[model samples]
Target chain A: MSQTRDELCWMTISEAAPLIKRRELSPVELTQAHLDRADAVDDRVKAFVTRIDDKAMAAARAAESEIASGHYRGPLHGIPVSLKDFYDTAGVRTTAMSKIFADRVPDEDCTVAASLKGAGTVLLGKVSMSEFGLRGHPTSLFSIPNNPWNLNRSCGQSSSGSAASLAAGVSMGSFGSDSGGSLRNPAHSVGIVGLKPTFGRVSRYGVIPCSHSMDTTGPMARSVADIAALLQATAGHDPHDPYSSKEPVPDYSANLNDGIKGLRIGVPRDYFFNKDGGADPETLDLAEQAIDVLEGLGAQVKEVTIPSVADVRASQGVIMISEAFAYHRQFLRDRHDEYGPVKFRFMLGALYTAEDYLQAQLLRSRICREVAEVFEQVDIIATPSMPRPASVQGDMGHPFSSLGGLNFLVVFNATGHPAISVPCGFTGEGMPVGLQLAARPFQEAALLTAANAYQQSTDWHTKHPVL
Target chain B: MAEHPLPSHDELDARLKGAGIQLSNEELEFFRGAYPEFLDQLKLLYSYDVTGEAYPFDVALFQEPQ
Candidate 1:
């Protein structure tokens, strides 16, 4: 009762965890605050595909009882979180925002979902996403999530609802899968944080496949520290996922505020900032300013280049479409009409020769080597997460878009590096832009530390979207 | 990357048909427009001399030390 419900809704997991541990903030109160906020704003934000109020409240009660019995489960113990509907949730319809899976309910939780549940997170129900995380599908089922900052603008896809919910203050934090920047794009689009951990860092055992080689389950939240907490809960090896890493999971928060006093940051501006490459001038300006902040924090910033990086979107698209078509081969052959606009994009894979796929895989390996050489000289690479700020929903045009354009994002998905998108600043038009930083493989801790330092030095994350 | 000319619209539609997939006129038009860009992406990889005779598995895509 001492703290207003508004404060409860906006408090990051890092801020609320200690309060909950001390019994000053009950899990039940915190969960109810978010539920109320969702009830008040979800219609316009369209973040959740399924809002299980009763189930969420019941879970909150259990968490409260467990903590009261002196059984605290750590930072994410009582957090209210949503999974991008791509994750399979037991007994819940895990529609990947596609009509093809609209009626399909899973009998088991995906590894990430089960792990978060085990960590005592209250499931706030599944959120909307692009059909198979492959851009907008014309005939998709759920309403596209709108940017909470401006109703006319859109929350970028695949991880649309995941970003929207955090931006709208209807959920504390969440997990969203990124393949070619699905999570980071939306994270920056809506003014939040998202981490695409190293490819195998988080298990993808139960996620609906976008591209098996590239699909990575990661965390999305309003702040970098909360992203670290979510990552901590679900990271590490999973026997079910063959790609899962056996690497030791580092304590993500231990060095979060350590500051990047002597870190080396690399800027690959030629590729990401090419105005001809779809980089918006304002977004690039904000990204440059963000890098300057990192330099001010004692990070050495120097321009570096990743060979053949400019054309990665082509490799990413070819590989993604081909694999996606393979996954949907039977569906496309049988229920072709059921696929939304994404089906057209997915089917574009069938157009590529098998040799094209092989070439893409080969290109991925080269990118890995190039990025490693760059990492040898710098601790992290910096760029704008998205090409621009959120555009008006109507201005998004048709669901289909070209993937061969110069893309800064898909490069990491191919190389399998740890990447984070932190709130950089807003545009003159009042939309948020993200400063994306990626580190060497399995170096998510370094990514978080630098991002947390940036978040701390700026008031960007503190400025929430007015619903 | 050999100079593989862009497939004509009829050639593309025939390719889709040959693959047992059918598309609406609008869908075909969209694919018809995007196919060139898609092929161009493939060309970028071949344009580079990176891939050798044996494509080695890159473990860097998995767990790599910082």
Candidate 2:
């Protein structure tokens, strides 16, 4: 079968791996097919900031030779993948979409990138992202990756290129980091699966820091099974990352068929579902329908209230801004002229008093305690990923105004929970809507299991945005 | 805890200067508008009563010696 018609672009890593293992297809040919598609669509979509086609093709050839010699790696063997610009790659520019680091190149791969490479995945190149992953419309003067579905619409932020590249078929799977809603927002906007594993599930060593408190690296792919496979390869303890969890990493792909039977799902009524100006009616309807579907799967669904979310969101912003400012202080002082306006101004605002930073930390403690209590009552919580789909393109006058009131996903980041964004449905305009599911701290396995169950029961994750 | 209004553009610029950072007039004006809302959202943290608790916002990784 022809590579394009083989559904390889949309197949789960689990499905694709078996075919390659049996020698039914060669990794070099598969890599070439994806590269061809990327070349045809990337100019219009602007999904990739850098393309290492020669290196990728060389790696693909090596994989084919290795397999022919009866040496097989795991599921990710020979799979072509891309990393967000923030991930450090030796001898490659790891610009975080900011001119501040425009000429900066790291001498080693990030822990996560090293792990992916160890799994025998082909490195495509660096994908685009926001300037320092800062707050602003993605279309700032810095690199703004366009949404593959609608060129003018926002592809979310931070992990902007990961989503666009995946949707545009630039790579099979890609790396995404979430300090706030970077991963989830782009996943929702582009109709892909984005997982923000438990805060400590993946190592953050060598990833450009946005917020040490909330930063997490995870996978974005076309299916939950693929995410599971990617996480299996990436999740582990790295001594270099002080915040890396020492907990035992479970086999995420081993029992993905385990259904969501007898699981307790909580819906935050007042905070998550309140008639806030945040979510549109259509998005809310899809969230409610997702609850019904979970109920039908023998899961108990109930409405719960999380009163401390307002405080949590507030504390998160303060701490993130304060830390981000501290990290970029020297850069802002020496290379101020080179930074894009959005990132430069945003960091400048972080020059508040140390008292402000401490006060935010104190508030953060209280909010974390409150969230821990809420988790005691339920196994997981569900909410709409975004209040609405991606805003119309070129509507970037006031970036935050364009965001409306959609702060649901950011709160989870503040609480340090494991969250995943899966496609729920599409809007009348054919834009994708996402259902955000979160589990308590260090419960990534449970979260992935539930997400896998949902994906198995529905076809949402299998649908890709047609470029 | 009365609502803490954001500092004026001049105040913000002065604070930036105190920290050894400089901003252009256009950049200052751009931040002068956006910082207010950003500060307002961040001020919500002060509304909580967290007296002596350690903030639980730091990342915790399970590490083993390589």
The best candidate in terms of TM-score: 1
Tell me how many residue pairs clash in candidate 2: 9
State in Å the error of residue A161, model 1.
0.1
Displacement of the residue A213 alpha carbon in candidate 2, Å? 1.6
* Cα lDDT of model 1 by residue, A290-348, tens digit: 99998999898889999778767766777877888889988887887887767777777
Candidate 2 backbone collisions, by pair: A152-A393, A243-B61, A244-B61, A244-B62, A245-B61, A245-B62, A246-B61, A246-B62, A246-B63
Runs of candidate 2 with Cα error greater than 4 angstroms are A136-142, A397-405, B1-10, B57-66
For each candidate in the order shown, give its overall lDDT on alpha carbons.
0.84, 0.78
Tens digit of per-residue lDDT, candidate 1, span B1-66: 456455665776787787788777886777677665655665666776555642322554453445
Q: What overall lDDT, based on C-alpha atoms, would model 1 receive against the true structure? A: 0.84
User: What tens-digit string does per-residue lDDT give for candidate 2 at B1-66?
Assistant: 666555666676678788887677787666566666655664565566567756565333223424
